[model samples]
Target chain A: MGKYVSVRGWLECDESTINEVKKIRNDFTATYNEGLLGEDKLELYQSGWTFPEKQINWTAYVFYGADIREYHLDFMKKQLSEMANIQDITGYFLIDDHDGDYHLCWQIYENKFIESEQENIVFNK
Target chain B: MGKYVSVRGWLECDESTINEVKKIRNDFTATYNEGLLGEDKLELYQSGWTFPEKQINWTAYVFYGADIREYHLDFMKKQLSEMANIQDITGYFLIDDHDGDYHLCWQIYENKFIESEQENIVFNK
Candidate 1:
């Protein structure tokens, strides 16, 4: 059962935080084959946002294999937990089968606050 | 000066339109070396959305080389113009230098209603 998962969200951070993320990207690349241009990872897109809410300052996309999606999710939580506690940051995780079998979505808040909105949506798998 | 361009937006379409997109994906792969798993194209992520807005039903991401970004932009306009004309559809185009030299953004509405919001954002180039 092959699953495709995408995790994306808006990040609120300053220059220091941005640098930290860059460092993380570099470290992730070296550590795993799931980094950008790596084996499991496809693309990592991050951009500063135009719309501002509270300290929300940027947006990030982590496009990697869903097989290790949970691992990456935990990584994200650990990395951004400190910032999210003091600031406001939110993102979403979406999962679906390659042939349109399953669809899972979760709304993620600051402290790994995840709220599952849907699961087993279509059931083709 | 290599540029990275990402074109993405939410699409409001039915199964028929999805089939059309799939057809386009296939045809594009054959026409250019910039399709899914092609040389220039990196990834194409499309997922059904849980959030509903009017007729907004889907989301699409087109990750490709910026060398031919304009061409792809035009193609998208032409392909989705019909759907946007009748319904509500919107997307965004963001361009940035690989080394943080430039940043450009545009808001795309139905019928190619594109509005430039930012340009020459930084003097890194």
Candidate 2:
């Protein structure tokens, strides 16, 4: 009921990648399966469209009632990039406990994750 | 522990609306003030840039462990549109109960909330 990570981003995909994208989403939707991750849950949304940008965007939140799912973002990025059609994963994931002003902004990947120095710039709160 | 709604969209803002936008977010941030909202939780995220689009995007999730916050989206849209510089809420909100495939797609505003037929379109999952 406390810790959570926010995922806000989009995948650059083309016609060849659409089915794979949906398949990946079906995999993520498995988070709703009973007893999979305990109280941990993920509410994922895909909004916007390809008419304007030709890419679909995703907005999601991963909940950790008591334990943060370690390397969850890494797993997500890996899955997203492993697809043949996903050109890129653009955007960041913010780890927030709602108890501090500073939070981890996961945006860069250089063998591992890097913190984005944009909590105060790209966001207002 | 089950029901959740996802929010993903951006506000058309200028210099005049920035402060007010931050103030509204501050008010929403008060949801973490100890005992507010009971077990209900909200994880809100702001991302993207104003350089290429001149607008920032927000992705959020509102959890209703046992009770759905009725009229929550209505109140949100009202609050978002009541501001001066914020232009429009261009995206829709989807409500999935995790028990059915037919969920509510709320996007249209014609006096009351209208359902958006975008569960399959705009989204692959």
Cα interface RMSD of each candidate: 15.5, 15.7
lDDT of 1 at A121: 23
CAPRI-style quality class for the chain A–B interface of candidate 2:
incorrect
lDDT of 1 by residue, A9-115 (tens): 33323434544545554554455343423443422321211121112112333221122233445454443443344333433334443455434554435435453
The candidates' DockQ values read 0.04, 0.03
lDDT (Cα) of model 1: 0.35
Q: Candidates' TM-scores?
A: 0.33, 0.33
Cα lDDT tens digits, model 2, A1-125, are 33434443333234444555666665655543444333223332222111122221332221111113343444444544443234432223344433554345444222233454432322323
What local lDDT does model 1 show for residue A25?
48
lDDT of 2: 0.35
How much DockQ does model 2 earn?
0.03
* Model 1 steric clash pairs: none
Off by over 4 Å in 2: A31-85, A93-97, A108-124, B1-125
